[model samples]
Target: MKQSNRKVSGTLRVWSGVVAATLLAGCGGAEPVHPDEPFPQTQEQAQENVAAAPIVESMDAIALDRTLTSRTRSLIRARLAQGQAQVHQQVPVVSDSGQQLFLNDQGLNGDVTAGDGLFSAIGDVDFVTHQATQDRIREFQARNPQRPLMASTFDNRVRVSTRPLTALSPSVFQPGVPIPIFPAGITFAVKPANSLIITDASVINDPTRTYDPCSNSGNPNGVWTFNHLMREMANTYVSPSVLTEHWLRQWTVNQNINGWTVPARTAMMPYILTPWPRVGGALDLTRSPFKLVAIVNRLDLGGGRGPAGYASGNAGELRFVFAAVDRTSGTCGVRPFLVIFEYGVPHSSCDAVKTWAQRWLELSAPSMVLGSSAYNAALASLTQQVVVRNAAPRKPNGSAINQIRTNEEWLRYPWELREFHLMGSGPSVNRLQGQPTVLTPGDAHNDTPVLRDFINANTPAILANTYTVPTTFPTASTPFLGAFPWIASDTTSFWRATGISVNEARHKFSLNTCSGCHGRETKTGFTHIDEFGTLSPFLATGMSDPSIAYVVQDPVNTSLNREFFEIEMRASKLDSLANQSCLASAFHRRLTSAH
Candidate 1:
């Protein structure tokens, strides 16, 4: 399952020397400067800056190294490529006691190990209140048996509104203003079905149970238990520092107000803000520019292979699934399982996420948040950043930012396998007895698996139109396109490390997935918060009114940052109400507590 350290060469060995000579000649004898050091004073020195500058006419040695490695990844490509060879890859597993287990294709097991960062120090909490807050979640869950799972209890009372681009951000993306992420008139359901949301408290509280097949009256393919949902919420919405620091003081000595134990404060404090009054309004998720996203994490059913095997039986396995619902054609939907680390743990786990954040925001100088522009810039500059690796031998840890790959493994399910499943014509094509066969032919190399599955699962009437894969990156023109382009762009480093081709690397690095669409250039060192707020529930007339308002921050109209905070705050409150827990109060205290 491990990569062979042995190095090999083909046409790349000759090109490596040629590239090095070209880069050296282009450098014009310019000496490399450390990113932290002062700039050279002379004009000559300044002229030499081209060596380290972003614009390079020739590939440098470092670039050459990446190039060589990318091309040399025969071993890597073989592992990641299609065919039976993948069956021997390691499967990640987590035990009931929070132990990690790795099983290979033959079901041979590997020892449990922790990666670098905070995961290696699992039980340590930088903040005392943090531990108390976790304790409170347990207590709250124990007391509120009737409380619905947080995932299922979504509120539809709040209305959605479109704010002008000028109002959203006067600083940048101006002039042609109001480029909202979604087009106007789209709304979301108040709440989806329990089956769709997977919000049952018992299922969430009990991590040991296996999810049954949909045919056996169990939840369908992609489902998220409360545990994973909360972890993701914290990973995205809560700052790592907030999770690891502040409020975590010794239990309030006298259980005093303003200095009370989290539980005591929760019991004593009225909700920080009253719930917004019900408003009769709805939003459509299928409308223009609005995309339906579904993320599901399932216990990996290992097909009864070995000690770690859970497939064939409804046992909790380790796997994660993601899909972008294409309501447009109704024929093709795109679903991708987490590619790396067969077991969900250490990659999708809350502890691992926090640790990754810590490395990005705490352990390093001038720390930054995962999606922040500064973080992106840091990754782009090799000299300015610290060295980090994906997956094991380096550290089995995965970052929340690297959504494309959990660790060393590409973070998505193999395209070939997914396509085969959808076609109902690949390896397991005969597995279906009554399920509809594919109505449209799917390209094994190009078509996405989820889109294929959608066609096979739905009737030709429901899936009226045939879906084609997108030809251009980031275009919304096609409904059933695979996400390989996005994934490739996101994982350029992995591709580079594996020595992929220049064309492949270009595809991986060229597209700017997040900030490219939401760029805000006029702001001064503004992070993600500076982006324009196009459509927000908080900006709506109903949610912003103080009398029944749910948003705690003052509405800026132009800043998505304000809108994001409000939504985070609201989600916290909803989390409390849904789980019948006091996490909202604890979270608030954690945010505000000086101790």
Candidate 2:
């Protein structure tokens, strides 16, 4: 399906002239910079930052260009925004890979001029990696000898994505008062779920796979439960051949030691981590060395046309965003993760799907208590109808279309997908159903697709402040759009020529991928569900921890520089699905606009 190249007029209005100003003003964003103000950075502070760590690179005059991927450009731009807090002083400069140095355009360190769109930084090149990060790469490179770290990485547009996160019903979810996005009586599971902590892995351990995904795990103490759904999806539908150990990673855990036992190190260590023993007794997600936070939600894809067709067999999906608390340490993958369960509602028709979505809205109502039987029944009604088992049809070798065979050998890889069976993003890599094969996270195919080059290319096309979404976009049968649509990594630097774009194309394409949405594509970091006790930016109204001043303006949308609440978009979808008559929205849609 081709994504529309159209722009959101309202967002464009608010976003109109910010990028240009950002290019010159450095980090002030839209704020006016006074002449007398001095930037508050010092050489001493810069040196102090690198005193303990090796200086991988040094730069004096830096000129950001289109050749740089969106994440790199945005990270530099965001660092500049943070410097805007202290106008007139030395502007702080940090590379996308987190190397901080004394950089400015005051012409002191070799900058031509601040107004010339050139920065004077103490870095040699745009890309740099700390020794620690390089060590981790060495770990991966040692095992995967066939995969070249540099060439394969450079060719494949891979980078560490920031992070990600659903269910429901029958006629019981009939629509109620359609008052805005979130109804008065409804309590979104996200709100209450945010408080429900998982200090121990057992909280999410549904060993029997008998618990309902919508309701809490069978355990009375677990308020947020989706382990059973995750187990089933990963073990059964995610791949052609069911894998019972899908949740486990057999990587050697000789990396940073946090929680893995001696035997657990060489054996299959759980990729997902949760703070155990609390050793320090009880600590919040913020203080815990390794913690697991969970978020649950239901999403409506679209109603299909009878059975299955180019745009038929559509069904709403359930999302489970598990934010690995990375505030602490451990490289053996404490990275933020997510898993998606398919067919949350019936696939008979779009209206039937909406009836199920309506049920979720009611279950999510704030008034509904966590453990009450009503909550249990509301969840059961929806989860019971979900279908996790599905097969992929034959596909050809086209850049636009995904090529998966019609056989039963569960996708051999973690992220390989052809249909909506199941999708999951581990710490480093990710791929999802209905997306282009060229966009596959780490697959180094015969040749790079033209669309792939266009996406990651750091060309002037993006500076135009509009994105040209490729018409060749892939869609299995989804019918709606929001953040992380199409159910959307690698470290080898985000310096790929293919990268983040602008406006509609930027959000649509970037948001479709795990990395694009998580890294600068949407002004996010680590996890959309990264917070503990507090609501995540995906649900709460804000960007990912922009604690510093002058958040680089969102080059793509410009509207979400400081605050972007993903929930509003999700809430609006639920409202439309549960409130708007499916008859009106269920009509046939073209491959382009259906999303």
- Which candidate should be chosen as best, given TM-score against the real structure? 2
Predicted candidate 2 versus true structure: per-residue lDDT over 1-595, tens digit per residue = 0121122222223434442232311110111111111112132332232121111111111223333221222212212323232443444333333344444445343333445433344232222221222333355456556743321000011111111110111221111110011111111222323112112233233323222212222442232333333333333223311221222222233221112111222312222233321224421212212222332443523322111122222343333333332322343233323332322233334345546656766754667655456655565455445523222222111001111111011112222122231234232222222322112232221023543455545233232112233222334332111111111222211213333343444334444344444444444443444423234344344222111122334443446553343333344345434543221121111111111
Q: State the displacement of the C-alpha of residue 418, model 1, in Å, after optimal TM-score superposition.
A: 21
Q: Using Cα atoms with residue i matched to residue i, what is each candidate's TM-score against the true structure?
A: 0.19, 0.38
Each prediction's total of clashing residue pairs, residues at least 3 apart in sequence or on different chains, is: 25, 42
Task: Give the TM-score comparing model 2 with the true structure, all chains together.
Answer: 0.38
Candidate 1 residue 521 C-alpha distance from true site, Å? 29
Per-model CA lDDT versus the true structure: 0.20, 0.29
- How many backbone clashes are present in model 2? 42
lDDT of 1: 0.20
Q: For candidate 2, which ten residues in a row score worst on lDDT?
A: 151-160
Compare the candidates by lDDT and give the number of the best one: 2
